[model samples]
Target: NTQVNLGGGEGLAFRNIELGTGLTEFESPEVISLLDASQFRLLNLDEKTSILLTGGAGSGKTTVAIHRICKLCFNKHVLPQDILILVPHHGLVLLSRKILNSIGLDQIKVMTSREWFRNQSLRLLKGIGKEVCQDTPFRVSLLKRHRNMMKVINAYLDTKKLEIVERLKRSAFDDKKIVQFMKETAIIKWMKEIMKGDLSVVQKMLLEQLVEELNDYNAIREEIFKDRKLLKNIMDDQSELITSNVIEETIKHTHKQFLEEFQEEDSREHTLDQKNISFRTPDDVSGTIDLEDYPIMLIISNALNGGTINNGETLKKYRHIVIDEAQEISPMEMMVFGHIIDQERGSFTVAGDLAQKVDPISGFTSWEDALVDLNLSQDLTELKTLEIAYRSPQKIIDLAHHVLGPLAPKRIPISKKHHGGVLRTIGEHEAHILILINERLEKLMEQEPKSSTVIICSSLDSARRYREGLRNLANVRLVEEANFTFKPGVDITTLEQVKGLEFDYVIIPDLDFRNYPVNDYSRRRLHLAMTRAIYQLWILSPSAFSPLIPNE
Candidate 1:
């Protein structure tokens, strides 16, 4: 069960309704507190609820989600590991992880969509236990364990003194008799025998003693190789001596052959086991199988249907599941999660700001649209809205509202002092605007050297052009969205990449309609770019694009 606190100034108490019944009543608050306190306390534990939080920039949606998660973990007595928080990208996951860490709940793991899928696949494989082999992708119960075991074996073989000595002797040299003698040595034969078998306690003890003797011989050989003059003299003969180039080529070919043999043996061993192996897609039938095609929904369903782990216990112990930046996730991805929720009987909490979505290029739009498309709303019984602006000032918010128009939701009013700074737009003439912007930036730097600023463009070409134009300005750095770092200097970025970030000053160049035509997605992205300015905003564009702005 999840509880939400919609804090503003006014209080409205609303009751939770059943599936058929709508929101019953909007009762007036008995106690009208100055700070609006709206609480959503879940009464039922069995019921699974899906929540959609929609708001523009400055809204306290993120804060509410964080608080909600913390409340569930500490107050509700939910285990930290059970609460899985999903974010859009790796960056947001890190940011959320930092936030959670700061709040003393460091155990909460944040995973991106790709990471989550990988983890789920690993977990499902692990449930099958040692009945499955560790060679093939489908057969391997755990990828890390399989890889680690192979690595250990490889390391052991590579470090074996007898093997190393044999390899060195096998290299072309005048002393063919010495090489043959080394290959037939008793020590080399014993080492091979022990390495081939699953050694017991007694066998391992005997091998350790043999390894010690081998190390001593290895040290002696290494000391001999250390004498550069002796080595040069030994290989001095033109026809009798083996050149270093020939030795290197022989070793490379031998290593490649050895690797091929090892892989073939592994494949043979893996196929010997008669396990019920199946593939999700036909494409994964050959080569390295990608288990990602095995839908998460199916895995979760099987797990819930009395699938036991190695310990013979049912694998259904998670308390809660969280999906952050849910707006960017596709309907198929959400369905995978929805199945997990139904199977595990765990609570689901998805946090995302719909207006901040910018992944349309990859086919994901908004959570609202995704839900409708996926038919996930059939289970969703409650809807909540978080409307608080904690990051920006009122003046900045006002400007954002004016520029964003219909897209900007009503945010909590901030003080005039909190507005921080004003936006100054110079004329759109390239050279003149550049001079004015540079002058203003220089003056601001003089006043506040520590203050940071961002110069944004809608396209990479324009960003490059602006960066090239500003190369003459000393200490004025041009940073692209790809190369964005938290440095106390001027940064130039694009609108798409600058979402979910705030800057002290934002200089928007090439904001003309001709350059960036207004569309539903573009307008939302534009709002995101405009609202990022915490202190100041400078929008430079042609007079033709001026009509887009509301005529005051």
Candidate 2:
């Protein structure tokens, strides 16, 4: 019999180690001890170690990670703030936040890259704006010069109206068109002459030109009777010409100067600023402020840097970082976050099934290569695999596993009483299939009494089509690309948009090869769609595409 020593530096090889010669009954302490010894051999945790927990859907990887975090926090005396958890999407953030809250770690903060960026931007804006305002005299002078240049241009045009009219007529222009054309042609030059060299003068000039152009349009339309087509063409040409010129000038002359100013202000403020603003909000309470108005990078930078130099104190402290749907995070972003945290002391957990990276258009793909790409191999100390699934039934897991190829291991045990559902293979007829799915959803809703039924599609187009096709169906809701809220009844949404969500019954309207190409990303998306059902899952695919599934 082979004997092996587990754990410790000095150990015999498993094949060479010998077991003691003993005949113990099954389920006895001796037998259980042997099993426990082998299991204990598999569990190893060391200081400053990185772990990769990989498994298919329904695998206990999440449970294991959570348990591991709890162990580190309670047993190891690691502060909750010292653990960082990164989830794939905002929806997963919500899910993880709920899980953390339920575990009584309510003070643990959950933030997305967007949230981090907004906080940083606000910090920069607060610090830089003061310096910017201190140079108010220069700005006011520039503004005044810009205003004078605009007045001169306006007066020049007013005094030389006939000459301007002649130029416009020569160019086959009407009064409305001529005014627009002159404004577009002369605005930039006028501004440039006024600033002497200040780029802001160009911005101010553009603003003045825009106002004058609008007033001119209004004045001429009410004052002059000109040909409608000519007026329209002139107005269109003028607007296009002015916008193009402004953009080109901004890029060529103003952009670099503005950037220099910003950099100068940033450098000065860095020395004087000592505080940074930090904002936090609960998942349920929506913030009314628009995030698009701020630069996301600045916000994240400030937050990760322990708040801006404007806020007196930093926000919530979190050490454990969990990034769910890890497969979707871009490598650049992953690198940024990895740099922000002290890897030796902080525990970063990334949970994502590679089989569900669907949003390739948004640069979303499997991040398995991140370990090598980011040179994180040295830091990754533990690689754990979770194979036991508790989400979907065995049948659904099986179907998803078949489509996901080798990535999805056949480890999830079959449920004893899975809610068996039909997998219909339709033909090129997508419309008829959608109708059938709608009918099934309606019937299911009538029978189930609850509004937990959902129709998940592979793409936004498919979701919208399903919604438009079933618009008249009562209690049926559609969640298209722009819609955020999840209403009751039969809801239709794309797979990527509905991650970390579940329904009592999920009907995948179309799972054909045409829709879900056998690419890395598409297959993962299909897997995500299949696994999002709690009780039953129905997949409708074309007969030709049925062979895409691996042999069970």
RMSD of each: 20.8, 20.0
lDDT of 1: 0.48
Model 2 residue 240 lDDT score: 34
Position 18, candidate 2: lDDT: 15
Worst ten in a row by lDDT for model 1:
12-21
Cα-based lDDT for every prediction: 0.48, 0.48
TM-score per candidate, chains pooled: 0.52, 0.52
lDDT tens per residue, model 2, 57-126: 5454455456556566666556776766655456555655666777676566666654564554454433
What is candidate 1's lDDT per residue for 191-230, written digit by digit as tens?
4454566755654555555544443422322222233322
Residue 161 of model 2: what lDDT? 49
lDDT winner: 1
